[model samples]
Target chain A: MTQTLDIERELCGHAAVGEAAVTVDGDRVVAFVVPAGGGLSLRELRAELGTEPDEFVVLTALPLAEDGQPDWAELSRSRKDLTRRRMPYTAPRTDTERYLAALWEDLIGVEDIGADDDFFTLGGHSLLAVRIRMRLQRDHGVTVAPEALFENSVLSEQAAVVDRTREA
Target chain B: MSQRTKWLLRDPSPEAEARLFCLPYSGVGASVFRRWPSHIGPLEVCPLQLPGRENRIGQPAYGDFPAFAADAADALADHLDRPYAVFGHCMGSILAHALVTELRSRDVRQPERLFVSSSRVPHWPPDRRYRMPAPGAVGVYHPSMTEEQLADEVSRVSRTVGGTDLHPDLLPLALRVLRSDLEMCFGYAPALAPTGCPISTIGWSDDADVPPAEMGVWQECGPVTHHVLPGDKLTFLEAPAELQEVVEKDFRG
Candidate 1:
């Protein structure tokens, strides 16, 4: 069996779970789960799996794609719901933070990036980071090392890097 | 007629050290490599023409990747006379891996190298994950996309990659092909079966669909050499000199 199927089967085998589909969201393994009539919990699901799942989103029913399979892509996208952010969504307040957030919008394809959002966690990658650097120099006239994006990718953190580098 | 003539849109070069079989991405034909030279250094470019697109417009498309791979491996059986490499972009990258795996099972000649460009690793089925809600933002096409949405994707990609919107007459057929191709991609979720052949994962600098950084997952598949060059997803279409240089160096060493 395929790895994806094996994971899905294991998810179904859980006594507390009704229906579930698994997908990779960037670096995380997210399971979109529909509970059995008895119900289930993220804590229980994680405990059952042994290793902690990155996320377990509870749903009433599994959504199927046109192919009649669980729509994993849509499920993956659903996990990125802003309402459920790990940290509260704080709008970009500083000048550099706002500028970085706008670039994040175009490159990551997400809008209204929060100052607290981690770039990699929010699906930002190397190319996007490089683009961020290029635009930072081009638009804001600040030069940040490539490692800055890797080490400090959050909007506020990155903005600070820009501020420090420009002053230097 | 030999599958050689039927599968390869152009004739193979007898003098080359190896053949580089080029696979097209979704909704198009072998013509995606139209601008590519006949050969890059010693490697001859043999672009494969699948059914239901381009020259084979009336034929039916393959239902899935496995069947396509099986048939392709068989069709190109005669051409496996020499060491060859496989290259694919986006959907073609998945197809490229499938074909390489199929060749291994058949115990036919194996590819010296497999170039998978602009795609996620095959272990998990490819999914369309839009990081945000932005206009003309396509995470990757899926079954549920509306006609209007698909049109926008087609326009945006064509404009971005090919530098012009698809012609009005070609839009309908392109959309049809695009939808079918997207379905095939979402359906495939293969195991991380590493090929005996070395893999070179190619990530485009400006490719928004599959970022260069994300291409690192391919290391799990096998011995892989990753390169993130300057260009977008379709930049390979234009056959950049830097890309050719990489293929030449890889083939030579």
Candidate 2:
């Protein structure tokens, strides 16, 4: 019954707010529609993919054809300026670098931890991750979800993720 | 005062019925009560900013609780000329109680009412362990744990206290303040000082740091009316409206 309920919930578009429905293949988010005003804005979305809209629109638009999918391709380029204003900081360098440096110093008492070193592998945990997130937000003025630390555990890898996120 | 101190004022009315002075908890400065005046009408809210934080970072922090109380009481003497009440949270609560006692000793008029939050009576010993880690010793407690593990612990503790994940940079400063507070509480042996002011005790529903059971110790000091709020944790910031209302009611009554 629980498994059926879970499946029912998933079939109902995972109940995610503003998320467009797309094909799901076993645990993967696969193709997803960029819900209008719900998904990242074009400027934010563009920063994540690190490509110009002209070069990437085709790839992004492909997912919109799926059943129950959102019309991501309908996003108006005229709104690019408004989207750019809402996107996170863009210093050519990602916030993850600053966060990682502060985190390493606070946790291990080391001046610097290599960007390639895994955050968890170096004895980082959820509590410290929240602390890192809080510090980044408070000290470095970076907004990061707690999951970011776990998803990209390495410092440089996290930076790459942030860079890609900017492109997207 | 010659020093440039940053103060977040919340004076609801220039001709307020009464003034309410609030003190912050250990490791926390006055900005915590910045929103109190907006909720509680007809009262002048003055949130006291202690040394060593925000704009006063250059000032040395008080080393002992009595010294801190003395400094606060001395500074507050001039501001107490009008109709006023006093409120404090955690260590600030105890300080508020002690300051009332000091006022009596110095023959100053007492506040209309006193509100104490999240701390026991002035004399009770603290229950938490005092384990101050030396410089560069991250392994003193859960050193081998991953950042996820640490963040989980922080989240759990914060859930119990109505706070979010602890900031990494602020953690070190908090630890230092916690150590000093623990030392003060641990080293304290209840003295014979007493105050005649009416007191109200405010407790959070799920505050593990200062449990409800231990708060009964506050009754030893003087007459106290206890009130508890419902929440996953007990924090002044979480229920500022409720706290302000209760304080205003108590002060008027």
Candidate 3:
């Protein structure tokens, strides 16, 4: 089996983790785990396993198919969904969102992105993020840092930043 | 005239005895090497401006290593009519190596030397720990961390090493370039084919990122000459006089 699977199995064996799934995101080994409840931290989990995951995401539950097998698509969707819900932002509704969404779709190649969709989770990287920023400057005369995407990846939040910049 | 094709070179030289094409590290443009003299003795400095950067801001970023190398080789073809060498620091090292292979595949003249700094073998899986949000912490691009946490990390880094402040206005653009370069670095897994060109690997005496000892692995690519210059990884940016002297000496030899 791949080392990622082995790590996932080990993580599941922990008393704090009821179930776990691990995958490679870029160079990072990301483990999405359903904890056994009652105060388990990533630091504590790493200490128990003696392995530091590139990213340790604590999930409410692992997505499973009707056959009781882990559903990979659902798991990916869950990760993105979890990210969107955590950030305090609404869906893209303004003209800036429409403009930014089109540019993001072109570079990230994703269709129908909501204002709540996370850019990084949608496979947005630094280069693509820069493309978005450049396009904003060229087309809209709005400029923000690349970290703005990292901070406010949601379309609406980013749009708000640009709107604030425009107003200022 | 052909300078349009080789837009990566901010300062193109047509009358120099030798040319040294310098590739910038992640998230930066050719402007990073703007401090370097246009001519070090007879060796003209030509800093490469990759796509999605300062001048090529509108061009699409190269998705992979081979494609980037191919584009660079094609753009640099006319300039290669004269003798030339290649230099890359950090992420630029991989570009330098891949570009050499691309040139060879096209049956073009090869560089006299391949100078790589603060980078590992092309095949090695990326060391994600290289870029930290804090001194010893990992910075995830995801929203797992609070926006405040992300801001703190980016601000801390922008204060040091990156050469400029994280001006809210330009930080995103700079980071976008960095991310694109990193994606290229992460996806790089070249075939185990060694080049015929000689290699020179530079390391900082106090660089914790790419230690001087780790530099020996570059020998697998070619006959390597390792040089551990004084100061840390950012030393090249802080005081380039020593680096310039070393390059001048090496090029002369």
Best by DockQ: 2
* TM-score of decoy 3: 0.56
Error of 1 at B247 (Å): 1.1
| TM per candidate, chain B | 0.91, 0.75, 0.86
Ranking by DockQ: 2, 3, 1
Interface RMSD of each: 21.0, 16.5, 17.6
lDDT of 3 at B82: 78
In the range B96-163, model 2's lDDT, one tens digit per residue, is: 77777777777666777788877667664333322233333221223333445444554444454434
DockQ metric for all predictions: 0.01, 0.04, 0.02
The CA root-mean-square deviation of candidate 2, after full C-alpha superposition on the true structure, stands at 15.8
The order by descending TM-score is 1, 3, 2
* CAPRI-style grade of the A/B interface in model 1: incorrect
Worst 10 residues of 1 chain B by lDDT: B128-137
Writing each residue's lDDT as its tens digit, candidate 1 over B1-253 gives: 2222346664464555789999988887776675565566678788897876654555678879999998899889888999899999888888999999889888788899999888888886555322222443442465677888888777777776655665554577678778888778777777788877888888998776777888888888778888989987678877887888888888776
Candidate 1 wrongly placed segments (more than 4 Å): A1-168, B1-4, B128-140, B161-163
Off by over 4 Å in 3: A1-168, B1-3, B127-157, B161-164
